[model samples]
Target: MPENTPYSLPKDSKAWQQAVDSIASLLPEDISLHDFDALQSLPVFALIVVLPAKVPALDIHHYVQSWVDEQPSWHLVTVAEDAEASFVDVDVATNGSTGTQQPFTPAQVFRYLLVPVTDTLMHPGKKTAAAHIIDDQLTTRLRHDLAKNYANAQATDHPENAALVHDNLVDCHILSIGHMLRTHKLACFDMDSTLIEQEVIVELAKTAGVGAEVEAITEAAMRGEIDFDESFVKRVALLEGISTSVLDEICARLTLSTGAHTTITALKALGYHTVLVSGGFSYFANYIAKQLGIDEVHANHLDIEDGQVTGHIQLPIVNGAKKAAIAQHTAEHLNIEMSQVVCVGDGANDLPMMAIADLGVAYNAKPIVQARADAAVNVTGLEGVLYALGYPALVASKS
Candidate 1:
């Protein structure tokens, strides 16, 4: 190993050839090299080596360290051990401009940075410092720019305190940088209180002159204090004799929650299969889905006769468990993996489906839902989901 060698591999130099030859000689015959790569930044140089199972981790570390020490520059070497694989990281310290470090390719892992978009540009050096603290190999693209109030960066290396580091980002709602932010092919949402501002049943109750009684039942059911099916039946019974025209009127008056349009529009443009699985009535859900361009809508059907509500609901009410089933079925029908699905909702009835999805987002949801969801967005609109999905503001805009 030559002393004072630059951090980068000199493709055309004798020193590079010698270093390669030395590494090959040091490896045990039983341990075969799976991959080899070199990464270079201004003040840091890294050589990544991957090996298959059954290699002695400590021995490789000691030998690699000794080899690195023979080099001219001060090099820091580390090793990562896995059940069937191992990675060696070598960082070289040098004198250079300590400005923004250009993104570098990592060896065998990916590093993710979860930060609030508003605070990302405000603290330009925070990311660099974070990368160093985590001992990441290189910073990749800002996965999500300052779009919908969140941003993320992808890099190399695994950080043990990933959650803690993510929470440290100022005003960051979620830092699902690593495995949590997988490519989602399907997205399922709850209609009432999630995609829309007011509950459709409550709106119908007011027209039926049972608003107060039905509202209490609705609230209790949403709070998980009552059985969804029973409460739903009770609420619908109060609307008996009400004109069917109420459904059309209520649907016309429905108000979409903030960022609802933006979120669904962006998801559609990104090729995501959007689904609205509601415990509410299809009378309203179908209309909402059409308006939002949702690909699918599944909800309860209200029975009517003589142009009036019969106080009867069709079979197979869409409850919590059913919602989950719908999500699973949708994923399977589309041939998407379960890990590639995102479910969002705001009520207790939404819990089951939320639990089954790869990433469950609580959108201004109930306390219980927020507590259990994988990610929660209480302060922002539905658009915040775009950020959670790792879509940058630039990409969101194009979508």
Candidate 2:
């Protein structure tokens, strides 16, 4: 190996000592390089994250998996082909002299880790126990919680705070393993504030001279502070007697979410089923779905008379329960399991449907929604959901 090759540490060097210390910090005080083999034989499973080389500096084959019957592990160097090299390896000298044996070499990309879900990691204390240091590498043990609680706990509560604790290397979460990407046949989306940028009712409220009032109620419902049913009715009543001309104008001006086009088109091209299940009005839902090439739509129907707003919705409001039922029925109708579905949304109304799907993603969601979701995509657009469905980062980036 070249003298200057990065991440290549000479045997018995200071860097090597620091590296060993880092790994040991994630484990018990007595564990060391000798314990690696024994630990690999433990009868437990963990959620492993191999961040693919999404960024140039992070050019490692990244992936995540949770299969039972396998031992818990933090692999620094697993076998990956051109795009499969996920972790860093420590190629140490085996001859007990200067650079004699070939251990795995690890890049700065997380070599591998074995962290237990300590209370401190999940619910960080007000201040660090130790003083801040420039060369620190933050680590959280993804131990054998086997259950998805570890991922969910880290995600729901001030996950961003954890990122700051790690100096921002932590991007998102992969809590539970969903159905394999290949099995995904259907993708369901919420319309207001999710599939589309603005809430249909809130936009309609603007034209009805009650924008502030409706917007307040909409925000409250989305945050789970107010019941979605009551909030929906109150907002609609405020729109009474509004002209239909406003509906058309608002629908015409409606915009798709930033990455919605890329996500929907990619799904269709790949032959995946796509649908819009919204608590928003059918008129707007259908309009957005048609434009996005969505296959179906189920939404609230607004009653109108003489081209003036009646503000009365027809039977079977698409509340949270209805949203989930629609998702289930769609899956059964397509002869697929709930595990084959991918649900994405931004509000409390979206949670039920998201819960039942194989992979439920909260996209730029309210704090309450993000906390409970299996995964949350706070930094990106709808295309981020594709990544949650196990799509290649390259595939999502193209969108």
Candidate 3:
């Protein structure tokens, strides 16, 4: 086995054949072809490493493999690399007969780095001729150990991307082949600070002559110093008597988060059912959802009377609890399991839904949000969310 480098997925058709040969080597000389069925039933995991496009494919395999070495329990069966992500087979996950496939354990989840590594690194090497190989069943202990390794990896920084800020780490994530084969059908996102770059409520407050008060209250809510419902009520009350036209004016000037269009397009193309679930007004969530091609929206409705802000909310405010309920109902209605539900947001209120989601994403979120979510994306754009969902160009080369 190589000292540091770990195994990676096959890069192309030729390397893929070599990988099959490695498995064949484990069989006895007189083993019959009928025994191949056992291999199919055996669990398999791909240590998908997504690097910045500028980085050489070989470095990506090496960078992640090195980290895998630190984990004592698992071993690379074989190592190969590719410049493009394997055909995800998006249709294969959602369409056709899936009854035959074995169900993955709920403990098994799709995990990834929020921001992929870039051209720079502290230790760069190539895939080696050998790997720290191991053959073990998918036992409960192994599963628990692998999960622990993932947590350790995230807390431990990569050789590169250890910058104080403006960093991208060689973050390695594991997902069972079973989970990977299931279609992630629903995508729920918070409107303010997520789809769009600004907070719609704060924008409305600025126009309503309550900008300072609202911003202060919003910051306090994020800081967990005040309750979301109370802060929201106080903030909205300050916007009383504002013209309804202000809603349209604020929506027109807001900018979508960087790489938002690309991320949403990629999700839709992959056949995901996109939904906007925000604590902000339906007025803004609906507008942004339309522009991004999102399928549905759930948000708090702001009350207006005589073409002016009434500063009152309709019943059932969409707080953290409501967000989780919405996500749960959406999954049930769509016939998708909670394992296929993904929630992305950037504030304290978004945490509840994230907690219940299959994959919780904190996008350019506060430090506390980043600490708690399944994954956090602060250095990169909205496209980083795609990486968390197994969409990055996981590159590699022949070992």
> Which one wins on lDDT?
3
lDDT of 2 by residue, 209-313 (tens): 899999999999998998888998898889899988887788877777756765676677556899899998998888888767799999988889998998886
Worst 10 residues of 2 by lDDT: 126-135
Query: Between which residue pairs do clashes occur in model 1?
Result: 3-72, 4-72, 111-155, 144-392, 145-392
Cα lDDT of all candidates, in order? 0.57, 0.58, 0.59
Return the lDDT, model 1, position 26. Answer: 34
Sort every candidate by TM-score, greatest first. 3, 2, 1
| Candidate 2: regions farther than 4 A off | 1-170, 395-399
Residue 330 CA displacement from its true place in model 1, Å: 0.9
Clashes of 1: 5
TM-score of each: 0.58, 0.63, 0.65
